[model samples]
Target: MVDVKKTSTTSQNVLRAHYKTLRPPNALRGNEVIILRHAETIAEVFPDWIERCKLDTTQLYPFDLNMPVRIPQRPNMKEAYMHDPPLSEVGRIMTQIFARELVVRNAIPRQIYSSPSLASIQTALDIKNFIGNQCGAICVDESLSSNRHDSKYWLTEKDMTRLRYCIGEFCVELQTEKSSLNDIVQDMKNLVATLVQKKKQHYVVLIVTDSLAAQILYDALSGIQSSYNEPLQQLYRKAERTFPPVSSTVFTPSTRNGILVMEPSRNSLRPLTRIGETTRPDFDSEEYVDAKP
Candidate 1:
């Protein structure tokens, strides 16, 4: 368990404190699979504290981190957080530092995939900026989305538009229903294949997703899915009070021959499957299409 009490509750500590999780010994490397939980959102679903779930512009994030806490107000034009809430003010800064750390580690991802949520996309974009254009439009995958199964709680139309605009083209959001663990494995495979097609120099793929979603991939890679769901430890690994708050899991054999790859790590690993409907938003309506890149 990470000791959140030792340091100030500021968001920067969230990143710096987690340093123990990524020491060079087991730190990220080329041709590895990085399953990361998205940064903090304006309203967090799985807040450190359970009471934050209230609509007090504070509690909403604990239950549905992607959704913000809201109160009754006069009907007016919505802000970015109204649809699919983006990262909080602190989350944005934390993510920038996280991206820089990845670069410092020489673990810059060749391709970045994200859950179809503003928070996840926001994290992916920051890494994209630090790593360069090799990351084309952030691959938005439904399979990598939050465990909140209801579309009503998912990204809004405006959220999708922002996503489309962020990617610089029509974005194809894969739709899914109750995806099993293997579903994510398949997505990893797709990413692996794409990474393989690229030059060997390009390695490390980042999947910016929810804590629950990231755990699914981590368990699949580490072969610990059924071991025990250790609370929220999926994304935040703890140490003997000496380690900082930790985040990140690198899949073994995530690469073979200097390219990304995935295979069964345990006997329980399931076969991959192709699931979900494809929804492509028109880029013509994108207001930023005409803007310089």
Candidate 2:
């Protein structure tokens, strides 16, 4: 039998490791606004805690990370995969749960803009449901998805072997594409500028994207100024992104508004199914399109 104490210790370690980006010594000020990825069902373990706080769901923005990526390897399949796939049922539920948590936390926004993707649109719908339909929501730019690419590479067997050999290196490359990373940072700057210009304090934006995009944004939020720096570098003294159990450390700003850090309750190591794997029906396949739910 597993030792309960050992397991608990391990779980805490895992949580700490996975969400290292939340580690503090942050530069947050009270009046400055904050933004985060969309709320997810994974945070349901502390349902009571969520109930206490309410989000400003009205101004919530769902930034889609699912922009098309061009992996330039095969002439036979020249086009890149559809990066902005629809949300899986699990993703949808998680999103709704996240929305509820935000509403409870009183972190909703007054104006919102999302990536022009169906999944983001759906998330916008949920936020509207939570905070009422009076808030502003729109898909302002396709670039918000950070979908910029003109080249590609195929992970052949040899490359896969090399990736396995040095998972950290490959994972870094996979996460840190120069073009896409820059685009995302620019998008974030735009969003922040809009908030500041509008003088909209006490508002929050929720961005939704793949883990890679999330990690990238999380790094930026933690004050990473350049994409050239390795993500795994600061995490572990001797670890890299390819290391099997990569976790981020997050630090909250020292604002009177109070900052909370939460994650999925379960410590299961199962792989998150890509949106295409579920009922979304090849949403990533790029072969067809849904009628826009």
Candidate 3:
């Protein structure tokens, strides 16, 4: 997302070449990890080859279902009108696509779980209908409930806007260890302990919750503790409540069964290789192109 241009064309070429030969990061190489989006949908974002390489078909699950699929503000919105406030028409379609994508590609998991939220529940049911009910799909809302502070108050559209502002401030502040990172950290720990304990060697668990809650929980699983390595609860006690949209990231633990990591495309995530702070090679350098002309 950050497009910091190279200082020179030569540097740009070198960077491109570097990528050509470089690999991807696999922090969770062998096993699966806690998902922090609408839940299992995070896996929907990654290509199937990545899952195959990691051999982690069974150990995938989301925390909850996706609700309010189309925020009126979203661009190119599909499934705009539906009885359910959550899960737009496009959402249902995309979710089905998500399921078919997995099934056609042989990425179906042995089990599925979701939060009790209206959206999460609907998403799970939709997925269940696609693959049949025997895939072990169910709703687990307790672990994926709204934030504690959020529970204390009602949310209005204006409140949602302010909450976004607060979340941005919180993200920046967390990076700096400034004032309100503790609660965020604790919430994360609770989410991780729950998701991790449920994992079998090949188990995939999806615990869908609100977006900000998901991010906080996922961050916790990555072992990102605060300045004192203190629990997130301590931090939460000091900060105000806020909600943010979910950002997606995939994490695979070590895989002992199926393909754990693959490089289908050059842009794909390859196995771990350390080539820090290196520049790419120039394509036009005598080695590439028809210099005869």
Candidate 4:
């Protein structure tokens, strides 16, 4: 088992500090969706897996349950892992930490939806077990999996440089026409609508997916419509480079709610307020800390 204590203490401290300030967007009291990328995967981040890959590049990467392996790139160090990898020990620890934090803050979701990938499913299950009754059922949804989308290939250092340049160029295009909503985006929107339209008015739904799907959902819910607008040839050119590692993004209905993007080291929730709008004073200032209910 990967020792959670070995992980950076800075991240844990940051989570502890900011967790005191997290609040359910008043506008989304009953309806809100939080999208998160799955924790690290065994095939991708485990030191043991890395050593194994180094020892036998020709052999198939092993899986806990003989899961598939999808290599999109040149089978580079980063992309050479099982297709449906399970969470690494570090990932399991992180999930437990996050779940415990949510429970302490009284911010546990009522419903959890995970991508079909083994890593996501494992993360969701860990969280469900940790939070107990504070969280509800876990559903696996294909729409949230990156497998449904085109492959994103990452190559050597030179290729990564080119990919970054492409992402910079694409960000500029975002200022113009919004990219047409694709089938995946539509499916995600439909899922959110279905959740929100339920008889219960207050529902907090958590979606655990790949970085690409998480980005798309963030763009959709925040009304940014920037990142996912490009065509396949242009979009996903550098999907991995777009977002920071292990980030959690929250989306609520009201403009006043703004968008909260949290990462492991960031001490405060970064708010992206809508144009010409200001967030509530309580939310705007971190000075006021509310007692956990």
TM per prediction: 0.52, 0.40, 0.42, 0.54
lDDT of 4 by residue, 184-283 (tens): 6777766655654451446667788876777666555544434355565444433444432244655554323453322112122232233553211121
Q: What is the C-alpha RMSD of each candidate to the true structure, in Å?
A: 17.1, 20.1, 19.4, 16.5
Which sections of candidate 1 miss by over 4 Å?
A: 1-29, 45-84, 134-136, 156-164, 168-175, 179-202, 225-246, 252-293
Cα lDDT over the full model 2: 0.36
Report clashes for each candidate as comma-separated counts.
15, 40, 50, 4
Error of 3 at 69 (Å): 14
Off by over 4 Å in 2: 1-83, 149-184, 199-202, 209-213, 228-293
lDDT of 1 by residue, 175-259 (tens): 4653544454566445445544552454667777765565445444533433222443332332111111114544435456874
TM-score of 4: 0.54
- Of the two candidates 1 and 3, the one with more favorable TM-score, higher being better, is 1
Order of candidate numbers by lDDT, starting with the best: 4, 1, 3, 2
Could you give me the TM-score of model 3 versus the true structure?
0.42
- Rank order by TM-score, top first? 4, 1, 3, 2
lDDT-best of 2 and 3: 3
Candidate 3 runs further than 4 Å off: 1-31, 34-36, 39-84, 148-188, 226-248, 255-293
lDDT of 3: 0.38
Best model number under TM-score: 4
